[model samples]
Target: MTQVQTLDRTGTDAVAKAWTHVRGNLRRSAGQRLFDQWLKPVVLVDGSTESAVRLGLPSSFMTQWVKNHYSERLLLEFRAVLPEVVSVTLETLSDEPQRVLKAEVEAPAMVPPPASAERPSFDPRFSFQRFVVDSTNRVAFNAAKAMAMPGVPQFSPLYLHAGTGQGKTHLMHAIGQTFLAANPGATAIYVTGERFMFEFVQALRSRDTHAFKTRLRSVDLLMIDDLQFIGGKDATQEEFFHTVNEFMSAGKRLVIAADRAPQALEGFEPRLAGRLGSGLVADIRPAELELRRAIVARKLEDMPAVDMPAEVVDLLAARITANVRELEGALNRLVAYANLSNETITVDFAVNTLGEVLRSAQRRITIDEIQRAVSSHFELKQLDLISERRAVAIARPRQIAMYLAKRLTTRSLPEIGRKFGGRDHSTVIHAVRRIEDLRAKDVEIDGAVRALMRTLEG
Candidate 1:
């Protein structure tokens, strides 16, 4: 019997050594379904650290699938068998495969790239010019534009808050693109809070946290979407706080977006909430009928041939009053239906196609539901949250609940006041003012109110 060497020597010695034994194990395990589908596609591009291995995947779908289903298992196996890989990252392979792989191999040795320097993959269709300004989000849109002007510090971290499908993400990207255009060399990064957390965890596991910090802190502008998801993670929050401080101290811009206000982010640390609230916070209210109609018209500009009746558009604008995402979805469905049926888009056809979504949007939220959410968030009895107690804690929370009820529901001041221990309507007015003042002046108070609002809205 002749013995044969299985591994090939390569110019990148580190990568070769790291994969010498792992490739054999993987080959043996290839029969497994998951190993074939998720793991087999990932090729080790380089080993920058003794504990971190870079992997290249063919597509984003495969990268996400592997990350979602098998990242931990892959990491564990690599760590146990290779003894060199502390973590494994699945990066999408670029069209220029060799160039991307070379960059990955050399990245660890070079100074970490600036966070803002990483150009975001923004959708050109979503720009300030294209976004229809209406009563619902005009203030937010104007504020974002003002903040985007070169050398302006009107709001360091403009927090855009609203329910999902509202154009918060669109606004953030628009600001980034606008800022870059104004300041040619200006750097900006657009990442979801979830991506921030994911990158932070990856850094921690690989013991390359210093590089991560350097990259993030070097950014001139950092925009985080869906920041409410940053709740419940102590380590990530700590890292984020320092990053925020560094950027703010250096007069760099930070923009964050969330489905609800800062106070509504349960499980988030108080200090993190305070930092987030320390700048201008604007809420993008749900779209009104006119705004929805404008959005439909603007979207239809791209598909002029797919015409719909005025009544159909009016019905959609009036009936499907959800967020912009739903609005776009309805239009997409109508266009597709028309193309398939070879029929002109009509009011009846639009109604039948989008009946379910329209009906769902019309679902009503009650004052009672708001009261219960408020009570739970404040850790008080349902009656306590609504009672006219003058104690600082109870009174403030009660006022916030009343404010939410007034703003979110169609309840009259007198009706809301009656629900809250039959207090006078004037009391409701006072509570609303108090909360509004606090929101404008006190960061902590603003965060708390926002958090409570999210609970109620949910």
Candidate 2:
């Protein structure tokens, strides 16, 4: 018996034919177990592009599993039947309800949007005109603005580090937007360090690394937020270091933002740290009173109809000194509460709405909590982590625990010593110095210390 062949089609028709062929082949050639476990959840989301087939998986595990066991086989079969397809791209569907809601709300507005026209580039709301540049953040803002100019390499990496809500992300985004506006066709990517690590790992595992390098290298500007998250991932760090080198060699701009300076980042490789520090480093300080007031005014512009008493604004500016996010959150609450209750906004209302968040931010975490968090992360018993057991494994973790406890907590050396199996105050000091020295000399040690600090702080 002879089988009939189907005629080759063009464009969307061709994509549909190719997808059907690939799916039918997988169902027949692969066992029921593999099909159900790995291939069942995969859906053909986009087939408009002739050269690529976009598939959506349910989760990261499924994506990894399919890529590991069946990616090559599936590609081979698909190519044999339809040679036009070049690659398969897998993405996981986001599960968050809020994301779904946000997408639904925004989808209608985005339909038929102009392709070449970008969204009002700089978040017109977040300009230097509105940014509260205090003494602490003034230098960093100026440096960032200078770096954003055309034909300037004032700072190659341009590392911006500070605690949460200290405007690192804001500055980095502003810089990217500024550059793109000034130099048309100057592309930039602003990604969190976690996303960078995720893409690096996925590319490495799938062996489509050339594509990865091209995606990162082809951009004229790269801005990474929360650089600390990638500190301990060796493979990601290696890939990122190469990307940094390529960008720097080409005189392309690189901007990195983290919660702490490169010298203070624990688990980051020394070589990576050295490269980061080679350029200008700016530390954004905590928001001052005037800066806080400016932030409030900027936020109020969003709700122009809502009236806030001047005294209430002053009280909030004076009281909420932690970060910009917190300050704005407080203002949001105050506005919401006042609007709902139909009451005049006052100092008393502001106090009531913002009391808990402010107090919590001011609440100091104790040394014991830091010790416990560090111990739990390393899988050592809390007692073992705090004990002076001089075993290489236990000692290193113990010393790191001590160092974090001292730095993150407000406890004195002697007080921290008492908590750590009653060691002498000098012993506590010694442990801190030892960890610091090791961190400075050894990249591996630095990575561990950084990992421990993140756990403790969290």
Candidate 3:
């Protein structure tokens, strides 16, 4: 008994340090909102002299939720911090005599048997800290941060839209997580479009419509993702419409995200569509090359021991231009293979490992896009660069943008000139030539051009 007690004490300290490291990473990886909800209650239950580790949660529900979504990553983080550790387990901690036996034996029988939840779950990995912000996503990111502030949100029903994998879901999750952290005990629910539909249908079928409505509307924070799918569901829409009104009317924070803007959602009721746009509407543009590189760096921060070559990361950032999710997946695949097989991830290895992803992610930049990129960089409107204004702010940026268009896109000088408010081909040539000369001479312009090039190319 003495030896067992001593071992437990020693193991507790070791596990505490390990869990601290793991928790930080988990909070960063999962998102603050989710970590607070699901993981904040967890503590070490299996602190033994053996290599295996176990975690105890307050309920079987939390245990199973983390097990399904975070088991692999949790184990990875554990092993990363404690090389001696080989296994990680999660069990419910409760006063029941059976609960003690359950943690000591296998798991809580209460773990939901389903592979996926019918309801959306908050992931701690989706917090604002984990979100890689840049020119493309800055507006949306800022808007999300603002909405997450304490007290009634200055804006209600913040609407975020982006193409798939572009962090619409991330922001939605981030807002919920951040808002919850600021206001503890705040009831926040995250529901996906399909999951919300299924849950609503089940409620109607089970004759539990009142309970469902009460549960969904009672939350202080309600976040709905992928609002585009709510289009075809007339019944669901009616309920969801009321849910929105309930939240808004009560001054509860409500955030809705979709692939398209409210107006662009086909078949959406006119009133609902109008209501969606009544609040802040922030759009996440496609990620820039620099942003992708930064995201890749952020993703690989978890694998400090992995000898991920710079060229390989650059290759992934440059090639995997689809969205953040796919980019992270590609990085994860390469890192996992390298870590498991003890092989260094090189440029060649990355190329071979992610051929299919690269093919699908191939996106060519256009001259118009170049103009937009340059205009965005200079904080000037796209029209400012194209207009006949000869101010230094407009003309210099115009020339630099033309130079970028000539270099980045395969557009002819005449075509490029036509793009820049229909100037002659010689004007485009002079602009390109003059900018080329200035790039070497003017440090500011040179820096601007180089930064723009990296943004476009990467």
* Over 4 Å off, model 1: 1-116, 364-458
Tens digits of per-residue lDDT for model 3 on 1-458? Answer: 00111225544566556666666655543334445677767666644433787777777888888787667666767776677777888777765442221122112222322211122235667889999887788889999999888876888889999998999987887787787677775666676777688767867886878757766776677788888887889999998889888878888788899988999999899899998899889999877666888998887786677777765766777667778888989888888777777777786777677778876776677888888889899999999988999998899999998887765554678999998899999998899889979977898988898688767766
Global fold similarity of model 2 (TM-score): 0.55
> What TM-score fits each model?
0.59, 0.55, 0.60
TM-score of 3: 0.60
Candidate 1 yields a Cα-based lDDT of 0.72
lDDT by residue (234-294, candidate 1, tens digit) is 9988998888888778888899898888877888888888888898888998876557888
* Two-way lDDT contest, 2 vs 3, winner: 3
Best by TM-score: 3
The 10-residue segment with the lowest total lDDT in model 3:
98-107
Error of 1 at 395 (Å): 43
Model 1 error, position 450 (Å): 25
lDDT for 88 (candidate 2):
72
Error of 1 at 189 (Å): 1.3
TM-score of 1: 0.59
Candidate 3 off by > 4 Å: 1-121, 363-458
Over 4 Å off, model 2: 1-124, 363-458
Higher-scoring candidate on lDDT, 1 or 3? 3
Report every candidate's CA lDDT: 0.72, 0.71, 0.75
